[model samples]
Target: MKTLVISSSPREDGNSHVLAQSAIDGTVRAGHDAEHVFLGDYVERMLGNCRHCRRSSDGLCSLDDRYETLLLEKMLPADGIVFAMPLYFYGMPARLKTVFDRLFCYTANSAPQQDQVINGIMNKKVGVVISCEESYLGATQGVIAQFQELTRYLNQDLVGVVVGNANSRGEIVNDPTDPVSAAANLGERLYTSRVTDYRLDTARSNKVWDCSPVGCPDR
Candidate 1:
């Protein structure tokens, strides 16, 4: 199994990235190959929203950008994905969101949503590693719901979420058996689960569309 870890934290060696590194280590320990790409180091251009143009679902962006082509190629080949980041104002960082937006454009245009036919494609499993200034008890559930929705759209299984209590680089190492370790364990579990069992363990929680226009018909 090939695992790809995406570290989207703004900090060069932030706690979130540490968790991502742990996951990579765990993947290797489980006899699976793992690679990581730090989005902060990449020169990715901000992706524009879909224009609803005459675009085809072939995983190719109509516009030329710094990282779009490369990222699309990576997305097509990876078997598993790990998204690691720190929550910024209850949302993802602008760069990470832009990457997601560009990917959305590649997947669909308007009206009905369908799968894209990329040259190298596979149904992959996805997991998230998070680091926050505060504990995981507060508004973190919202983030989990967002990732769950994203995993559903990508047709990937969400193994679990790992949260670390730190705001600086390498701070996650303080807690040896905390979310960082859990992140590593999650990676090992992912490698084993990929071959032994493949099931979507959807967490029963809040409805993502609860605050959407449809969910709030009163609007």
Candidate 2:
């Protein structure tokens, strides 16, 4: 199996990137091919102006940029994907969100290859790694909810999530949680695990989206 590890941190060798590398190492150890890419490298060509453009006859995005190359050549072809990034405003970094937004072009399109593109995106194994400064219980909730909903919508299996607490670059190396090992384990599980259900496991007493005046009363 081929797995793609994407690091969205602008700083090279930052905490998030380090974890991404560890995930790649795990994938390799599991006898799978792993490719790592820095999402910041594609920031300049990211989707923005294409939002208003009408879909072409081929049902492709109007903007002609390398995102197509990244999606078709790297993302779609991979059997599994690991998204690693630092928390920004308690959510995903803007660059990573942009990539997800661009995927909208593939939806509800009539192109002959649309089915292929959609199928490539759906029902894949996925993993997540997040590095945040705060170790508080809710520090990573926003981003976690986002990924959970996204994978659920795409019919993908979210194998595991590893959150590292690191405020400074490379600080994750000293994190007591040992997120590096956890990330590696997540990567290995990405291939070995099977998808019994695509739904988000929300049976917990305190579900994040449970917005009520009193908050989960059961909790």
Candidate achieving the largest TM-score: 2
| Model 2, position 38: C-alpha lDDT score | 84
- On residues 1-219, what C-alpha lDDT tens digit does candidate 1 reach at each position? 888898887676788888998999888988989988877555456665455342577434456555554465565678888888888887777777776666655555442323442323336777788887776577577778887777676656787788778766788878654887889888887744432233588564454334766555312
Off by over 4 Å in 1: 41-43, 49-64, 109-122, 194-219
Off by over 4 Å in 2: 45-59, 110-113, 198-219
lDDT (Cα atoms) of all candidates against the true structure: 0.71, 0.82
Clashes, model 2? 0
RMSD of each: 10.7, 8.2
TM-score of 1: 0.74
